[model samples]
Target chain A: MKQLVRTIVLSDSYAQSSQNSPELEERDPYNRLLARQRGIRLPAELIRDNALTVSGLLNPEIGGRSVKPYQPAGYYQHLNFPRRKYAEDLNENQYRRGLYTHWQRTFLHPSMKAFDAPAREECTMVRESSSTPLQALVLLNDPSFVEAAKALAAESEDILDMFERALTRRPTAAEVAVLEELLASEESRFAADAEAVGQLLGVGMKGVSADQRSQLAAKTSVARGILNLQETITRY
Target chain B: MNPYFLDHLKRRTFLENSFTGIGAVALAGLLGRQESLGAPSGIPEAKSGTGILGEKRHRPVKVKRVIHLCMAGGQSHLESFDYKPKLAELDGKPMPASFTKGQQLAQLQKQAGKLKCMGPQFEFTKSGKSGQEISNVFPHLQKVADEIAIIRSMQTEQINHDPAHTFMNTGSIIPGRPSMGAWVNYGIGSEAEDLPGYVVLTSEGGGQGQPISSRQWSSGWLPSQYQGVQFQSKGDAVHYVANPPGVSRDAQGELVDSVNKMNRLFGKTRHDPEIEGRIAQYEMAFKMQASVPGLMDVSAEKPETLERYGCQPGDGSYAANCLLARRLAERGVRFIQLYHRGWDHHGGIKANFEKTANLVDQGTAALIRDLKDRGMLEDTLIIFGGEFGRTPMAQGSGRDHHINAFSMFLCGGGVNGGVTHGATDELGYAAMEDPVHVHDLHATMLHLLGIDHLRLTYRFQGRDFRLTDVFGHLIKPVLA
Candidate 1:
């Protein structure tokens, strides 16, 4: 069994290959010889982990009791056996890896379910990968993602830096242009409304000093756009 | 022969053996091509959002939609629809040991030896033209008695709450199977573009609210999209339906547009279909932001309509959910399940059952009447029942869970109203006449929706898994 495992791991097909290679472009169902460079979206746990890892909010510590991160209010409204009210982990556990997130067999965390996490009521052979509006909503509106965006904005120097932090590469000129325009518009909007800025900043446990509120909110918008990119969540 | 064994029959063997083999015959029937004796027709042709079965069904469609009103905890048949005067006369006497000898019992298992008979809690009156005897607690339902077909001999395998709920919903006590709503939605798809195909709404009041898990509506082993999306009556109708605190609607729209643009640009280099799917979902998410809020706003509903349902809009009551079910039916949601989780009456059967009945009776009758009035009754199927029934034997003032017999009702679309099918014994101990098992109910439901229960199978783990799972017989008397 060990020799078989070694042989399988050392196989030529297991070697890393560039996804962009023209040699991998066989379209026929039967005649396809090389593996294509299709990007598989990271599982629900890793998706959350990637966002936190890039934002520098991940606790990095492993092996502990399951944690509860920020979730929408009344997500557990239907849940009863004692009629639970979801209270997120207040300490650093809030930023812990998604692997440690509580697995409620019946009602799983919504954000995780959106990214195709199994309910774990029974053994699952393979996790299904689905793209739906709920996934978009999770990335765009879930407080955990929003909190990660805020943290990413605070740490980055600019939009390009934010892109680098999130996607592991600097954006093209066209991408930078679009983000700069979004940042400028968001800055003006936040400057006009102090309450909106306060709402955006007062998301997670961490708080920024009052002086850099508007600027930070604008950068967060830019950071949010970068984090929400399809490439950011997809593992090539 | 069990269809499960046919998974081992290879295609070459099936073809070479031709028309003589049992494997070929079963395969032909499963593929819905027994008449043709050739390749299955319309195998690849599916309706827009439907799963396997597509537009071509095994039989002619009778109902276009299904709305299951699940009374989550065990609802007693003795008090509700089943009229047993003999049980009332024998009340307070020791129950016949012959009836419950070695029978599965729930909370009353400990007191099995000294079990005392309990009569119907509420008074029964023959109501409507059919003279269907119903409990006085359901006064509103009594008015619409002729519009329903009551089944008194409903039997289930599981006696406990959670597993029985699973059995009632998915036709199996085991988890990880597509729910009834999921199966129906997957078969025909939905007409509502903005809303989900299968929608679940829940409310609780009157008794100890048992936890109705999200698994009740899950599309287990099926594609995730077919799973039921819970629409909360209060707050944001769907989780994350609302934008983040600071983001305006216009800002969110701008962000969506920008994200889609970036996705399209990324697609040029990657050539992955998922990128395009991601782009489409963002647009859908933005559309849901607008549609869901409008859907939840019931202020536009006329005062008379609100009065009929006996609910203030946005109060998160069963009445409001019934109203919403109608709205959802109108918009073409394929399956809508409204779970009222307060029916487990272990102690105070009379008072607790009455309170719970009051919570759902008016709304249930209102929904039936409203649908009939709207001309949607002909194509909409309404199922009202719980997981299982309560015992005839008493546990103090209440009853224990009984698997021998229960009651449920069918109304609207292809149902012979003003009729009672099947019956329990004189003592209301067990189903004596025409017992309707959970699988039979599932089969009949699928039959009404124009699907053959045996044919609508999903192959998983080398076995053809169906809702009925090798068991199911249609309850023919109730069919219109």
Candidate 2:
């Protein structure tokens, strides 16, 4: 097994002598294809083959709403996008396209700036060393983080129900007690000011405060509870 | 250790069986340990590998902080710092074919008419006792000319916006390396425990000239904590930083205590390094929720300061960002990078270039004066320049990108004042003597900060990396 592992490693590097060659391209397609792949559907498909082109995902007419990609960005150029008229939605007047003509060689992505995506340049393997207190803070309090967490939780709720369905034997008394304690805490927190918040909004509160700071201190305490619940930051 | 294979030892005594089983398991454990240890060398030590958490710098530094006023796009050397008399002699004449040798031109070349070498659109006069010939365009910067070190031969690797911006910010023309600000944060952690070490500010015309993005101030291989925290000059600088609903500050504290308790238990079991970072960040975030909003508020500033930086109290602009940078510097932010973009005056050379210069020059001079008044100038280093310079020859009426040579100004800290360390050719086409590449400039800046560029390294991908990246030399002439 050791010798086989060594052989595999050697052959892999030998086959991929150049990191960005056709060999590696053939070997990995699905992993490299993000969001626009089989599962998570992208509204428009950006063809990366040669010319920068944007094609619609649906049939050419009905849901096949596609517009031509905008011009590539130049040095010191204003990042502006073209406007499109849609009869159905007044808000769909303009949308900004990416900077590259399809991932230009050394240029940065505008979306990467809008969304802080790591620009992998110097090395292939980036080490995620945990040192600063900012990372967790940003995750807990950054509005972007709050939105992502809520979206992720909502999507994974169905999977959580599936975990409950697959159970052949009920949990032990201790396990049941632990879950009950968590639910009880959530209930108590909700009871504290749900009515007050609802009154401010001129409606009764439907749920506990979704504010992350309220949950900021509770994130880690409930992280295990969350991970053990069924889905681990994943939909399935 | 395969249990099925051990079963074949029928003749083995009970004691022998016990000994052999234990030995087999121990051997297996040893092999597994090596596999786990196979990760590349220890997390990169400090460049010199002498201090705890990379705190030991190359020397005892005088500069406690740095505020780099990055002029994005291309700030014209001709109109601002570099004064060329020969351009007047060759005004509207064709650029000699000999001068065009091997030079690639941006769209400006195709549009340039008969190589019109227009002289300074604005007048140039000697400023202060140093007799530095600064253009009238920078009336304010001229006041501090005696305290500035202007390097007219400063050059870069690229002419285009994205690459040049990336090269200036990070060491490489490519993205993903730690930015200079991030490196400073990594080398010298933070004086303030609650706030971030590095902070970024931008001017209102959208910090146009330089490409200001997360990559410009990213921590890269270093932990994300070292990354610059961007605080806008307008409207609650950081988004979603407001306190959540229904949670009193005390209630929030209680929740944090509960989370920390659980984390302590999990950390003991898993020994995850990130777990500790998370705990620290959570506490910092809680504290930041109170401090950050206060820090960004400028309503308390005296009217004089507001007029000095040309800042509108509630508006976000370059002038506002410049003043905010000073505030952050006072608050102990190790590195404050300000990007004021829109300097590329390719079309309306006279009209556009002059306008952009007016926008920056006054505010920049005010920052220097403000720092000096506060007694922070002595220990605070300030850098002002763009990625590269505009061409010596005309591109139509406007100048194109000239990477061969340009100008940059350094003031305060340990830089020698009233000096121009290098020179460009007669036409200012290229560096004639004492050529300083971006790497060399980086080295010299680090040197002023008491950091040796070569020695200040972070190991990444089995090799040590640095801001200068295998090539950089401290220009001893510029140092005091």
Candidate 3:
């Protein structure tokens, strides 16, 4: 048998040649280290061969150690919503949001008509498809969507007020105009009948002595509507 | 591509161009062959819709389309169409041993009360030139009797509600199978490019029982892409298709175009049908944003036509659905299945039948008459039947489940009209002469559609399955 002598060496020149240029110098310290690790260029082909040979030597039965059933290739981090402190302690805002949470059966959560989400899950793989016009009409006229739109407009007003309180400057004329039109349209559609408005306000046709409850309810809808504005919903 | 030798080739610099061993030579040869070989016959090239399968054979003699009206639950034949005077004579008497001997019992009275013979609850009179006996419950159907081909000896395998409904809709006692509409859709690819080939419309607002489920229109074993498209016909018909607030029509169009571009970018590399399907769906979605509103806009229909069918424009009623079905048929939908439940009447047979009759009789007749006047009846097939029929004997002066005998009718689509084929016994208990099984009816339906039921097969799980799986024979006597 002949014995072979092999010398392995690491050179700075080779390492420098393999290093990738940084995307930006302004990257955070943690990101910079991660970028350096990612940019380390090695001959993957040679590394793979050496790995196989080393693995084969360590576990001689076949080649390398077999994967166990319990060990996964990678871990997945799940996103979860924060829990409320108490079930009965929910305010009107929280209650309204919860009630508006739609139980969408076949597709993504339908945001109010103002958001323009798809009606159902669209299967992309097959050529054949069908959709009814009624869906579009429904979205245009549904009371649920109308209420959501109104809430969104009111939310914008609240935001503008908050901005004035914090920044001490009013929202631009363009922004205010858009918000006003949205609010007006929503208000007009919702005010189709005075009886309906009375019902929503939770008040009787005849004035009652303790009418503060009805006034509060009516005010809450406007506040909630302001909260539901596109500006409020979208992350600008 | 050759994993074994390629693994060694990458590491062995000395063996780069040298064919040192039989393994290297063999592997290289295999890799070369793999790249050069063309696609097999089973899988067709993408984008060319023709390749998924062979071109569907549509015989010139075949009926163009079908509109099936399934009255869910059992419709009492004696109270509706199959008027038996003999049952009137045997009223209040226990069914003689001669009558009850060979029949299968679905349910025992549980309380051990003797079954009493019941006569027709409503008066039956001869109507039309053919003098077909129709009960007063279906005055409108009686008017169109001459144009109808009634089959009074219809029998199905199952007796229970769910299974019987399943058997009638899917040709099997099992819950999952391609429905008759699905089968028709598969046989003929589709006529309308925008709409689905098979459509289901149901009116569940004022019915007595549960509405027909989407399962009845499922394309089981076939791709979910082939399932029947359901139309609610009222309110917002499609779910979630409204435009966003402040988004103009042009802006929405641009957004759809952007989405379509993204789809095309992802779809270009792979030959997946799903990606292709997505591309097609986007185009439809954009067009539907305009067409669907127009399609459901029944204001174009004249006031007289609406009055004839007794339909309201936006109300989601069965009568409106019938009018919609005719419109869909005109739009070239291959198959339309309409279901109206609540025919199961064990008591107040007269009143219940009258209610059901009033709800559907005029609308159904109007559909046929309208189709005929428009010259669509020649190409469109019409079929009306229930899951099964009710018993002749009264279970408290009414009827119980009877799956052994029933009545169903078909018209137009080259069928011999003004004729009654097959018959029930004098008491309407069992299929006595020219018996037509549910399988046979399925076979006949496919036959009318220009498909050879035996030949139309879809291979699944290494076995060929058909609409008339393992059984069926077309009744030639009913064909013109």
Share of real interface contacts recovered by each model? 0.48, 0.18, 0.03
In terms of docking quality, how is candidate 3 classified?
incorrect
* Model 3 ranges off by over 4 Å: A1-236, B1-58, B101-113, B205-207, B239-241, B248-283
Clashes of each: 0, 16, 18
CAPRI-style grade of the A/B interface in model 2: incorrect
Best by DockQ: 1
Q: Write the per-residue lDDT of candidate 1 for residues A1-236, one digit (tens) a residue.
A: 99998986687644545253323332421113435333568999999999999999999988989899998776677564668778899999999999999876557888997787876655555565556677888999888899999999998888888898888887787788788888888999999999999988988788876467899998888878878999999887
Whole-model Cα lDDT of every candidate shown, in order? 0.79, 0.56, 0.56
Q: Provide per-model DockQ scores.
A: 0.28, 0.12, 0.03
TM-scores of chain A across candidates: 0.90, 0.30, 0.25
Looking at candidate 3 chain A, the ten consecutive residues that score lowest on lDDT are A70-79
Candidate 1 collision pairs = none
lDDT of 3 by residue, B1-480 (tens): 333222121111111122222122212222322222222233222221111222444344457789998777677878777889998999888876576665666563452346668888889879899888888878888999888888889999888776787888788887557788767765555666667677787764223554354556766654334557676555544544544333345544543444344334333322122333334444545555665666687878988889989988546667888999998898778889888877877667767777887888888899999999999998888988889998887767457788889999888877887888888999999889999999999988888877777766655433556788899998878788
Cα lDDT of model 2 by residue, B1-480, tens digit: 332122111111111111121122112222223223221233323221112224455676868788899888878888877787777667677666666655676765564444556565667888878888788888888998988988988888888876787899887987667788878766666665557778787663422343455556766655445667666455555543544444456555555554554444444433222334345555666667777777777778899998988868536567777887788888887888887777876766887777788788878988899999999999999989988888867766677777888889889878888787788777777787899888998888778777777666654433567799989988777778
**Per-residue lDDT of model 3, residues A147-212, tens digit only:** 332333223335356324322446565545543444344345434544534444331112223333
Estimate the lDDT of model 1. 0.79
